[model samples]
Target: MLRYAATRILFLALGLLVASALIFATLRILPGDVAQMIAGTEGTPAQVERIRSDLGLDRPVAAQYLEWIGGVLTGDLGTSMLTRASVAGELAAKAQVTIPLGALSLVIALAFALPLGVVSAVRHRTRTGTAIGVVSQLLAAVPVVWAGLMFVVLFAVLLGWLPAQGFPRAGWQDPVGAIRALILPAVTIGIVEGAML
Candidate 1:
């Protein structure tokens, strides 16, 4: 089990590395001046050039990648290119909402999925298995937006059981309201994702 866990951790790291490289490559290869985009309309050519130099966009792709990897390792995401705000702080704030929602969604998904998957695999030749498979496929094909909309309509508009949107702006202060607002959307995402599993 230790070996298995280690293997999974290694694979996860490898996947993240590959994904980061792809993102960096895509940003570089995409048409248009990234420095200019970052500088926006207020910047002169000189300002843009300075931005590029500061960002090390002037560096070779491999060098830039290494710098990025180093920063990531050190938890230094740097500042926002546009606003010059702390990127790490912004991400940390956002994670409060995203992390809880994700956790709830994962729980909801697994609640449905584990049993459905077990039953489906166990009874593959049976009519019940066919029905479950068909339902899973149908749900998987349903776009997330459509699912979210349908959920909002049902629970928020019709039955009035949950909030449709406007999650508590109080941030973590109103934990109850925050969790309540997220339930419907999380469930929607959960069902859709669980269908794939």
Candidate 2:
């Protein structure tokens, strides 16, 4: 058990290293200079060079990668180039919505899937079971983004039942509003996942 756990941890660390390296490499390869973007259209060449130097972008690629990975390992996500905000803080703020949406989606998926799956299994070969199976397959085949758009049209535009977009500025402080905002998204994700199940 100890050996297995250690092996898993080792592999997980290796995977992270490889993923991070690829991400860093990809960003480096992309067109457009980060310093130039930050400096904007009117920035002088001297300003761009200074911005690059300040960001340590003038260093060797390997040194930059090492510094970045080291900071990540130590729980410093570094500052965003555009926003100049803490990357970790930005991620944490987004997680407030993302985590809840995921949980609610799973809950809704399981709630519908479990009972419907059971009925479909028990009534195998019957018309009701066949209909349910067909519907599930159809739902599963629908693209999630398209489903979300259609749902927004039906529930938000036509029925005027929910807000079409954006999270509450107050976040969970406005519990009822938060949940209302999430309901359509959760249901859209849930329908697809439930169909798959």
> Candidate 2, residues 58-132: lDDT per residue as tens digits?
998889999999999899999988788999999999999999999999999999899999999999999989999
Badly placed stretches (over 4 Å) of model 2 are none
Give candidate 2's error at residue 53 in angstroms.
0.7
Ten-residue segment with the worst summed lDDT in candidate 2? 161-170
TM-score list, all predictions: 0.76, 0.96
- After superposition, candidate 1 runs with Cα above 4 Å error: 1-19, 116-130
Best by lDDT: 2
What tens digits encode model 1's per-residue C-alpha lDDT throughout 1-197?
99999999999999999999999899889999878988888989999999899877888999888987899899898777667789999999999889989999999899989999999999998999999999999999999999999888988999999987658889779988998988988899899999998
Q: Give candidate 2's error at residue 57 in angstroms.
A: 0.8
Task: Give the total clashing residue pairs for model 2.
Answer: 0
Show how many residue pairs clash in every candidate, following the order shown: 0, 0
| Model 2 residue 137 lDDT score | 98
